[model samples]
Target: MADFDVKPSVIDRVRDRPRRLQRLAVLIVILGMGLALLYPLLRDRHGAPIEVRDVPRLPPENLAVIPLAASPTDDPRRVALGRRLFFDARLSPLGRSCGNCHVPASYGTLRAARSPGLGDQLDEFNVPTVLNAALSPYLGWKGKITSLADQLHRVINNPRHMGSNWAWVIETLSADSDYRSRFSALYADGITRSSITDAILAFERSLVTPGAPFDRYLRGEFGALTSEQIAGYELFKDYGCIACHQGRNLGGNLIIRFGILEDPFKDGFFDAATPKSKRFLKLRVPSLRNVAKTGPYLHDGSVETLEEVVRLMARYQLGREMPEEDVRRIVAFLHSLTAPLPENFR
Candidate 1:
C-alpha cells in the first residue's frame, strides 16, 4: 500500500495539543496577533468578560452579568464645553436645553412619566436616564440610534424635541463671545454641527456613575449586598431575567420583544390612549443601573413601581407566577445597582 499522507492545519494541530498547552499557545497567539481571535472566546456577545460561578443547576461558564465601569475619559476641555452646551437653552428656539429633560438630580432623566418637548408636545416614550448611558450600545426605547451624536442630532432636529436646526444653532452660538472663544480653543472647524455634537457627546459620555453595591459585590466584596439582595440576584438569574438584561449596563445592550411568553400590553398594564401605543411591542430594554429612582417604569412609563414591574416581567416575559416576597427581594437586588451621584452632577 502506498504510504498514507495526512497533514493537519494549524488550528487542528493546536486543538490536538494538550489542553493546558493549547491555552498557552492561544495566549501566545492572542498576544502576538491582536485580541480579535481570543476576544470572542473570553468575552460575551457584549464584549464583557464571561464569568463562571458555582450557582444552582445553571451552567457555571454561562454567567451573563458583568459589573459596570466608567467610560473612557474625553478631553477635559471638550467635556466642559459639552457640559456648558448641555445646560444652555440657547441651543433651542424654545430655550429648552438637554438638561431641562435630563435633570441631573433625577438620575439624568425627568420625574414625570413623559417629558414635554419644544411646544406642548409630550414625548411618546419615557426618558431613559443618561447616567452610565455610555455603557449602552444603543439609545432610545427602539434602539434605533447607535451613537450619542446621532441621538443628539435627532433630538435637536425633531419638532417634538428641540425643534431647531444647525443653521439656527450655529448662528445663535456664534453670536456669543464666550462660545466663540471656547469653540476656537477646542475645535479647528469651530462651531459647526459636528463640533457641537462632539462636544455634547463628550459631556454625555462623561456621565458615568460607578460604585454601585452590586458592582462592589462583583468585585469580591462579599458583604456589600444584604442577604435578601443576594437571594434576589439568584432569583433574577434563575428566573431568566438575566437573558435580556445582561452585560455591564444590564439591559440597554439588548432589544427584545416586550413579551416573550405573553402579551404585556394586554394585561391591562398598558394604556391604549397613549400616543403610538401600537409601535412599542418590540423595544430596547432600559438599563437597570438606577432602577430604584428612574420611574415610572416601562417604555410608556405605565408601570409605576419596581415591584409591580418585576411581577409583570415574571408573568409576561418568563411566564412564571412570582410570589410577592420574591418580587420584593428582586427589587431589593435592583436597588443595589444604583450608584452614587456623579461628581458635579448638578
Candidate 2:
C-alpha cells in the first residue's frame, strides 16, 4: 500500500464554530420556551365550567321584549326594491350572500354565538339577531356600529363579512338589469354604493318578528303560553338579568363585561385559550326574543344547550345555583319567543 497522509482543513480549526453551535442551541431552547408559554394563550375561551346558582330570577316586567321597527310601507316600491337586493347573492365577490349567515327564516342564522364565515372558520364574535335590529340604538356585540345604514355599509365592505369594497359592490349591483332599473326608479343617483347600502338597510329594517305566543301573552292572552313556559318566564324575571337586559328588545340598551361580578375569565370563559384582551370580555347583552331558535349560546358558542346557558348564567351572572329542572323550565319559556317569519321574507 502506498503511504498517503491527509491534513485537516483550515476551516475545521476556526474559533467561531463552537460558539455558533452554542448560540444555535440557546436559540432553539428559547423558541421552545416561548411556544410553551403561548399554548394556553391560544386555546378556546368557551369551555369554562359554570355555577348555576349565581343568577337571580328577575321580575317578568323587567324582562321587556324588543320592539319591532316600523316598516317602510309608506314607500312600497323602495321596500320591494330593497328586499330583492337583500336576497341577491351577487352582492358578494365570493358568491356568498348575507342570507348565508343571516338565514331569513331561521331565527336569523347569524344570531348564533359565533357564525361560520366563508369557509367554515368561526367568526370572532356572536352574530346578533336581525329581528327588531332596526330598533336597536347600536349594533354588533361591541356596539361599534351606530346606525343601520352605516352597519350595512360596514358589513358589505368588511373582508370577513361581505368581502368586497364599495366600488366592487356598486359595480356588481349595477350590472344586474333588475337592480339597475330599481335603483334608477328609487333614487336620483342610480346604482351607487350608497344606494346599495340604503336598499339593504331598508330590507333589514323590515325584518320583524311576527306575533308569538309570548307576544300574545303580553297582549293579555293568559293562555297563550303553557304553565311550564309561564314558570320559566317567572324564573327569567326572578333572576336579576332584568337589570341589564330590560327593554323592548330585552337587551341592547347597555354594555356589560361578561364575568364582571364573578370572574368569568378565571375559568377561561372569555377567550380561555386565546390571549387576554379587554375586548374579549366585553359584549352586548343580546335580546331574548326568538332565543329558542338560536342555539350554541354565548359569545363563543360554547354552551350547546339552552339549559346549559341558563345554568351558566345562574352560576356566573346570578352568583347562585339553579336546579336542573328550573333550567329546563326556563328553556321552555324561551321557546315561546319564536314567532312566524314575515310573508315577504319567506
Question: Which has the greatest TM-score?
Answer: 1
Error at 303, model 2, angstroms? 1.5
Q: Show model 2 residue runs off by greater than 4 Å.
A: 1-74, 110-113, 117-120, 268-271
Q: Please report how far candidate 1 places residue 261 from its true position, in Å.
A: 1.3
Give all TM-scores, in the order shown.
0.80, 0.76
Off by over 4 Å in 1: 1-63, 273-280
Per lDDT, the best of the predicted structures is: 1
Residues 35-105, model 2: lDDT tens digits: 89986765433223232222335333334654343354536676677777776778888676777777876
Residue-level lDDT for 270 in candidate 1: 74
Clashes of 1: 0
